[model samples]
Target: MLNPSHLHRLFLYGSILLSQVLPLAAQAETPEEIACYNDVQGKVAWNQKGTRTWGEDNARNLCKGVVQRAKRISCFEAGILSHNNWSKAISDCAQTGGEAITAIVPGKQCIYNRGGYALTVQWYNPGLIVFNGGDADDYSKYSTPGTPFRTEKIALGQTSCTDAANRAAVVRIIGQGFLNEGITIAVGTSVGIGTGVLGAIACVGTAGVGCPAAVAGVSVATAGAISAVGLALPEVKEIAYIGVPGSTNYLDFSGTAWNVGISNKVPLSQTRNFAKESAQTVASSIKDFVTGGTPGPRSITFNNQAGYVAEMVVIYQIYKDFGNGTIIPIPVTKSSGQISLGFSKHIDIPVEIANLPISVFINGVGTTKNQILGATVPANFSGNRCFKSFGTIFNPQSSNCN
Candidate 1:
């Protein structure tokens, strides 16, 4: 379980980072901390510039406008400032920066959950529809009957995503849905889907949330094909991001013939948004795509593949994750239980599948929050096409699947 974001030597540096943010907050309580909030932009932040010569007015102007008063010190971590004009703020201003990771996977950024979990994503260009217990690696043969669809910000219902625990569990359920039906995760690896329910860690298999039989208001007969992940979280935070925009089309394409690639970057940022649109746009929505709908890159009927009839996006109340190492957790509720950790906990986050040409790095100390932990190295990057060891042993143009 070595972290891939940094080198092996960096692994020694892992202990350098305080494991818990709470302890760091406690140890770093300073009178120089200041909280700032820009109501106009909905930005909530804390500042440590109070130790300098800056006054309250100077702090406000320097940190931008705060609706209330700024503090001179002591417990300034409540996040953002309020009007009261006092020497003390409410929150721990020790950790001054927001986590905005710009690496790993493709879709968007990974959002850290203080609840001991996170939301990660993967981008799939043209995306792919994979099956349960199927190898997600074979993007070329995704449509070749019996293969499962790649997971995207799959589905969501009329639930609320504010609850971090339920959110994590629901996302795990989505990964589980594919499993109970016979699969796991990664576009193509033994690493089960993602980590800690969201993405980029380790997923537990126990009893947790259940899929709402309906997705985007339409009933999806799940027939009890998903697993239960009983992961309870303690915090929620943000992670870095980069890559492409996500769409159920990515998931839908997995069930089609178009060879899709990975890396999630862009995001709609709301469950309602992803669900409302994916239901209509993504081909997996049996109610829509099976009947009539607008034809596009996702709607085209291919003679090579049959339409998806049962496998549907089941997670709901999403937070829009584009899996650039980010997965907007879909918060669906079932009876509460813990992800039994029933099986091996080594389930890794999927390694990058270089199906498309892209750019950028997955920036993180490799030990930081939202930075995916413990992934097997020498992750196979070879994909789709049939090349050779030294050169082309056979036909260079042939399929690797062949």
Candidate 2:
């Protein structure tokens, strides 16, 4: 019912509204675009130096292709490297699938060490790259071996830089000392003082105050220089020559001298001498007792029916009980492999006939037996009454004598 012009006006307004609404609906459906917007906003909130929100033109140009979009997401997700070192920055940029770009900036060179070696590193693109020297060559070659170069990958979402300048400075000082003393800085060679490049640097660095000459005696000779360097380091108690080739010659760090040669060792020698003297005394006494012949060797046999898994040790003791209530216990004799289940093994033991009113106690593995023999000479001997305890079973029985 509307006029043509009015209808055309209404259609134009509806088309404009639909056009605006369509883009938003499309954006809502595309999760990647929504994620990009969220990520961009978060980066802006964390606004570190050298980091900025990408402009519309710059974002469009940089985020061209599907691969480029993925790279963009990864770049934003990576942490910002804070230190202005060429090697570290290049490594950081490469981890996020980018190359480090450097530009020469005048009057920013930093000179370190007493040798006046000058180096410059300026972080111009945060995680992207850093400006170093006048051109970009391999940055890793410039780093010293002892320099505590951070090789650990930066954790995602970390934005702090580990300062390597302090550690590098200490290395340069130690390197200069070695060079002045005319000592070759061997990479893996074992110094006489048992210190290498990294160890020497750590020793001086941990001292907090400047390394003193007395701490690590940095002298002209290689041995003295290495020794001094080792002494200067913390946790080194004493340094003794262990007479081994290479760095294995260093003594243990027990704050005491460990003598390696036989010239000064006496403790072990004394122990051996004492053991020999004690053995001789025991052998002489046993010889005299057997030659006296007051009692000949008497044989005692033990028989068992429960087969032993292996040869078991048995100990026998003789105790004489007088009628006056005084009992004397003789020394026990130990014999191994003399007790068997199927066969009987005899043990020759010397016994005094005057000690005839004696009790014989036999114990082997888990079996114990006691036999009371009266004062009659080989006539009043009774059979053994044994109480056996093996594992969880206990059996008390009288022995059958043949």
Candidate 3:
């Protein structure tokens, strides 16, 4: 309908408007501004110095790049960031300092960290799976059944290996996940298995599994069978370490064998050496406790028959919850429509009159808004001096006679 020259001018004007609007729209969708999106919505975040968000299609493409080539990968390939950001936020956690990042994808680090061990289980789908330290406390066990393979980053700590600081960092990253499964956590050892929930905290063992704090020399498996229904929180925050409180001459080796009698008589130096060995065990438990993870070194006991009584020093830390100033009020109902109070309203009236003769009573009590304040009374009851006594009976300004 217009001349060619006019049409060209209109196209230029439209282009200018689009160029200005597009960037503004993009800015509004920054990572911080983006709301939680669903699986279908396909939103992903990358926290490198700061948060970077991408929509579904773009997020998927970027996730694939990072998972395969990027220095770090977010937990959600295309989902709500709030729902899953533990691992993604710290996948390259080691690079971010000593802090370890927990990934929902169990043993993901182990898979990449332990290149020698072949990965057998496929974690492409979501479910419960053991990430590391399958049936034993050895990283090598990752190559064995019941153990999910992991690379260097995912491998559990090596016993007696001294990397206290790094181990502490990594332990913190996985503490919550391990505790939910009732799996013992330590720098050298970690276990993850299907627990029926994404962030389940307690563990339910298979039937017939049992563990003795100290198994007599015998080659058999032992585990405490706990239910998975609601095992989600570790009851205690930390465990105190008492130096291997057990008999010096009595020794149990992984329920596999026990050497008793004449062989038990080790020189005093060897006895001290054994306690030194336990120091690492104690260290591991302490790390778990300080990091809010389950205690390592499950149990220790002594044989009464043996004349060995060792006094291992114990170390324990108390648990406490410092208030953060968040208060919830309690609400309460009353028997009578009108609540009443009983007190000597007159300052002139002896305080003893109200304190002895009448007692203040409240009927219904419940929280209103994190605070509790409620009372009820019968309409037929006589009004107390505090309510009815006027100027002659009491003066609010008077000081207590007592």
Candidate 4:
């Protein structure tokens, strides 16, 4: 038999154990464990800056999202951008009245060698066809505008053209140059450079086809849409929108989109896509509002002490976490567009306390978590949010990182 006091003690001890175990047990299934980890400490690539001094090699990956095959070709055509002498090559080809190469499809041919000291090859076999097949006269099949040739002769010419087109496609896709558009062909269509009908060329005993640029005139209106409210969660920022077109994700406190924390959350399919959409949104938005939105020569500065990477990311993150109200009424801004709050110089934590919630006390004095203003956060770090003194409607602890 147990005394009343003993029974009370047993109940109290059991209650304590149950309380701790229950929370942990319940927490096991909660979405909270799929956490987002952030801590600043990575280096920003120097070429990632917008300055021309970064040069070609460095600029390749930096301007990847902003610069495309067509844009690269246009840059070369304009003469300000230079890479692999391709622009010059295209210009030279253009001057000769050769058409600009367009899209390339891959196909193969069997080169038949005629017996004797002389060499002859035949086309018509299974192989990859390349886009951007060059001039129409370049192919051997048709002699003139109305003339049709024998199968053996046509095969030989196609074999030759296939080789040239294939090589060109490799160079175009891999090289830092502009991609050509496509032209109509009797069989269907073929790609070409600059502009004109595609003629297969004979070089290296094979014929090749030209391919068209996959992305042409991709506009803001065409991209898919995303919900802004669902993306407010920190953990979801990493995985949700990085790859989907028109998806939303917060710019980290550090300005760069390709951060460790950001990348870890991105799925394999969306890595390049998320970066592309983000760049387009920011660039297009700025262009709409600012006269010369290029903002040439933007520099990225890292913080040595805390390992913050660049200024743009920090400012962007600030806007993502807290600047929606600042630019709402502005004429040029889109409803989905984000606002920019000028960079801060303070390292005090950034908190979202709209209705003034409870205060956090360290030792009896109130203080917040550390956050740097302006730029220089590490790639891994998320924006600094103070301890969430719990209580309030919809103000969960996850909103503010301790």
Model 4, 1-402: lDDT tens digits are 999999999999999999988975564311111110000012222222323233343333222222012222233334433334433533432322111222333432122111001112122111111111234222211111000111222110011223222222111111111112221112221222211212231111211212222212210111111111111111211221111011121111111122111112222232233223333322222221211122212212111111111121223222223375663211111011111211112123233312222222111111132222212323233433221111111111111211
User: What digit string (tens of lDDT, one per residue) describes model 2 on residues 1-402?
Assistant: 999999999999999999988985564222333334444542532224545465643333232221112344444334333443323332443333222111212221111111111111121111111111111112211111111112222111111122221111111111122221322222332222122122222122222233323323321122111111111211112111111111111111110011111011112112223123222321221111111112224544433322121122334446678769998765454443533223334444444433433333334444333221111124133332221111100221223223
Report the Cα lDDT for candidate 4: 0.22
TM-score-sorted candidate list, best first: 3, 1, 2, 4
Each candidate's number of clashing pairs is: 78, 2, 48, 73
With candidate 3 superimposed using the best TM-score fit, by how many Å does residue 215's alpha carbon deviate from the native? Answer: 27
Clashing pairs in 2: 216-228, 217-228
* Residue runs of model 2 more than 4 Å from their true location after superposition: 1-90, 93-201, 204-208, 215-402
Give all TM-scores, in the order shown: 0.18, 0.17, 0.19, 0.14
Q: In terms of TM-score, which candidate is stronger, 2 or 3?
A: 3
Best by lDDT: 2
Overall lDDT per candidate, in order of appearance? 0.22, 0.27, 0.22, 0.22
Ten residues in a row with the worst lDDT in model 3?
Answer: 253-262
Reference-based lDDT, residue 44, model 4: 20
